[model samples]
Target: MSETAMNAARMIDMLPDSDQHLAYELIKKLVLAWDPDFTKLTPEEAKLLNEAENDEFVDAEDIDWSQIGA
Candidate 1:
């Protein structure tokens, strides 16, 4: 991430929970303005996706969904 973006994120983290939504909305608007398609992934999301790629694959037929929360 750029230094400016890191600073912006730090400032947002300092805001109260209620005000965080405002910050998020502002950033979201800016992102949409730049890329109307909304095809971009935030750095954090990309990191999570990279991590998930290294995880073991699970087969749908090998598991039962009903047993998940039982």
Candidate 2:
């Protein structure tokens, strides 16, 4: 893996379950916003992200949406 990929993996691994899911989603959004090729992710990274999406520890409802005011 490239240094960036290895760093991202290590950072993700260090996060709590909730934070890991949040980071995965944030990274996914950033990738989409930048319109990068999705295939840039290695299979292992993709698998880790997919697993994060299925994790139940992160509660969307628990987030303080008011802080993101329009």
Candidate 3:
């Protein structure tokens, strides 16, 4: 890892639990905004990509567990 990344990780680690969570969320937003990969896609590909992203519809607590131990 780069020194800059290491420094950032250290700073993140020093945050209190709630602040750490907020920092993580801020980082996620930054990463999404920093990439332009989606902008280069053809229109049709973009539509399909968006549909697949939307298709990941599971909620954390709503998962089916009927076959978990089978």
Candidate 4:
């Protein structure tokens, strides 16, 4: 990350936990405004997502949903 971005993150980290969400929302808006089509993921995010894609799991159709509300 760029020095300015790192600095911004450090500043955000110093905020109280209750205010951190506000900081996050502001950053998200700015990022979206700068690139509305943004969909790129970080290398670590991509790696984790790729691993999840290959994980074994049950199919949705096989789930016993009737037991959920009971």
lDDT of 3 by residue, 1-70 (tens): 5678799999999999999999999987887787645356656778989999989677767866886787
Q: Which stretches of candidate 2 lie over 4 Å from their true place?
A: 36-70
Candidate 4 per-residue lDDT, tens place, 1-70, comes to 7788899999999999979999999889998987688777767779989999999979989989998788
Task: State each model's CA lDDT, in order.
Answer: 0.91, 0.87, 0.82, 0.88
Error of 2 at 63 (Å): 60
Deviating ranges (above 4 Å) for candidate 4:
39-70
Candidate closer to the true structure by lDDT (higher is better), 1 or 4: 1
Model 3 lowest lDDT segment of ten: 35-44
Q: Tell me each candidate's TM-score.
A: 0.53, 0.48, 0.49, 0.52
Cα deviation at 44, candidate 4, in Å, is 16
* Lowest summed lDDT window (length 10), candidate 1: 38-47
Question: lDDT score, residue 55, model 1?
Answer: 90
* Clashing pairs in model 1, backbone N/Cα/C closer than 3 A: none
Candidate 1's C-alpha runs over 4 A off are 39-70
lDDT of 4: 0.88
| lDDT preference between candidates 1 and 3, better one | 1
RMSD of each: 6.1, 15.9, 11.7, 6.6
Q: Clash pairs of candidate 3?
A: none
